[model samples]
Target: MNFFKNIIDKFAGKPVDWDELEEALIRSDIGVPMTLRILKTLRERDAWSWVTANDIAEVARDEIGRVLPINPPPIRPLPAHPKVILIVGVNGTGKTTSAAKLAHFFKTRRHTVLLAAADTFRAAAIEQLGVWAERIGVEMIRGQYNADPAALCYEAYEAADKHNVAFLICDTAGRLHTKSNLMGELAKVKRSLSKHDPNAPHEILLVVDATTGSNALAQAKQFHEAIGLTGLIVTKLDGSGKGGVVVAIQDELGIPTRFVGTGEKLENFAEFDGRDFVRNML
Candidate 1:
């Protein structure tokens, strides 16, 4: 956030105190574990001995980049057939919207994209995905109210092959961690994907809202522990401006962030660009 820049500005001509650095880190939502690590690095560098604030800033940016690898890891693409992706998260985290954004991204790459509305638990969720499919000009597979989510994924997989699509994006119902039955349903969806291809649900992405602050860490830990998250998509970053949470996530789970959402429009979503992101947040 701008707090980091403020720290750089305030201590321009002053010695870098460990206490003040710790306070700024906590204020920026960098978890204590990572903050302590940063402090240790600075202390070892003799940062308090004779370093300028600009020197401290350079160290800080490098430390952040160290924890977060800027390059995207090699992703498993559709191999000889369509790739299936299961997008999940608690409600209000923009899971559906991120799914649409992903569909748009794949479509732009000239891949035939298919959408599945498996979130029948919420009628609005189903409708929202349908509208996005139309706006993005992609095929959608949906079921009647109260249909089994696992069954929906199975049928969507079949439909994708029948239509000769390149990718199938399944939007699951959003529920909190308290809903064990719903969480179990998510596991079943992954299990069902094996019915068609053992690696059908090739990627499982957990969508999170950056504005939730520390709660985002909790959600990431829970979802990652529960159903093996392959990557993460964080939304609402433009509003919160809290960039430290990115470092917090990397330090906590090691699940790399793949995409970021800046605004409501479809074009607002972008591949995680660490250098540009750091500059914008500062």
Candidate 2:
């Protein structure tokens, strides 16, 4: 979160060097478009000749604030059916864990939550969510390895409806964003879920590693284009101080980040707040 401090320190006692400022902003992984926007604002300022490091930080925070939503609406359960949330991401992005954390998030609020181990491509994935389900004291529907994930999710919806569950979170198998076959399979899952309720998968959330920086933005673009993403779950933000991807994705794709994982523990996960995020950057 203090990553912006580096930029502030760099120009602490000197007039802002346009080239150095641009490089610093770009290197922060806020994306080229956002970096350029910040620079342009600084150049057009009334005090452009004597802008300080603090001024740079203020402008950056203001621009980022403008791009991000102050408060994205929270996910709420439907009245007649369970609200389905599909957790998706590229390999090694912590999709399963985030799904579990999300379940825990709702359960803590005293809402009935059901988990679907739809990542049938990986045997360990099913077991992993099972462990969390047990710990969270919730029911989980799982299928065998290599099973059709679309079919598995369809069945999970029926189970959720039968038990009057408030939320059904499906943790889908991780795949490379570049693979059309894998992405198509994801689209199939969305379609299968919709069979129960036209909008069965009420939320499609993409989990991304904040440390991956600009690559996270690219992944969001591909996933959003493939099946349409409703929001994002950004992870591993406790250490990297690379939360700029949250702003970058929101700015570029107009996909709001709904949640963030600050650490490995379940409690580390929480809803995203634009104002708090901008305030903590320095």
Candidate 3:
């Protein structure tokens, strides 16, 4: 979205222009507290004196990279028998679509993928996930409407064990972050699944919609605090949303953005590359 070019234009080769820089940061939803911290760091080193507009842009990019967990999270292949992956997020955050794309990604890698439609609270959730499972030609374990999602998870884990699949991906129901009971329900699912495989739910991938802007940071914070997320997947980056929440969450929580869902297509999901992302933002 020309994120870098816009930042450079705002700088205009100015000398320590806090107003312009602050506007860029705020618009990017870096937040006032963190934005000021970065600005203070820049000012203390007299960066504005020697840094040109282009140099300032580079510095901005570098600063983002530095604050973020520069090291990428390890993408482990199917561990042992079924490497369980628990996917969670609020409604309208592309949780279902991401699950399908991820399954396709692993299927292309030749992993025996098993999808669990544990979002029984929403009938459409099961149908949607089922559609993707059929499309990918992978097995799916599901339950009836408003059925016990935790039970569905348990069944899926058992089925994965019985079939000896390479990976078991559980698609949880979408609920708001503010709903404590719903979040608690997710915790229950994790605990229930762990009974079958202690090391199960190897990865808790929290999906965040890039268009949500700063709200993405809040979602990450809430989800991480609630369930100890292993990584993040930002969706809808293909649209004009700035997607700067990736920087905010990385800077704040250090939870790596493992994947970015660029578009609606199955191939749109990609591994989050720090170097390419920096280049894109600049």
Best by TM-score: 2
- lDDT by residue for model 1 over 1-282, one digit each (tens)? 454777778678888777887888777776888788767877777744676677667777777777777665645456576788899999999999999999998888788999999998986788899899999999899998898989989999988988788889999999886677778888899999888998768888889888887888888888777888888898988856576777788878888888888899999888887676656655
- Native-to-model Cα distance after best TM-score fit, residue 165 in candidate 3, in Å: 0.5
- Please give, for residues 91-139, the per-residue lDDT of candidate 2 as tens digits: 8988999999999999999999999999998758889999999988999
In Å, residue 10's CA in model 3 sits off its true spot by 2.3
Model 3: runs farther than 4 Å from truth?
13-16, 31-34, 45-51, 69-71, 239-241
Error of 1 at 44 (Å): 2.8
Local accuracy by lDDT, each model: 0.82, 0.92, 0.82
* Model 2, runs deviating above 4 Å: 46-48
Estimate the Cα RMSD of every predicted model relative to the unseen true structure.
Answer: 2.1, 1.1, 2.0
The reply for model 1, stretches above 4 Å from the true place, is 1-3, 15-17, 46-52, 74-76
RMSD (Cα, Å) of candidate 2?
A: 1.1
How many clashes show up per model? Answer: 0, 0, 2
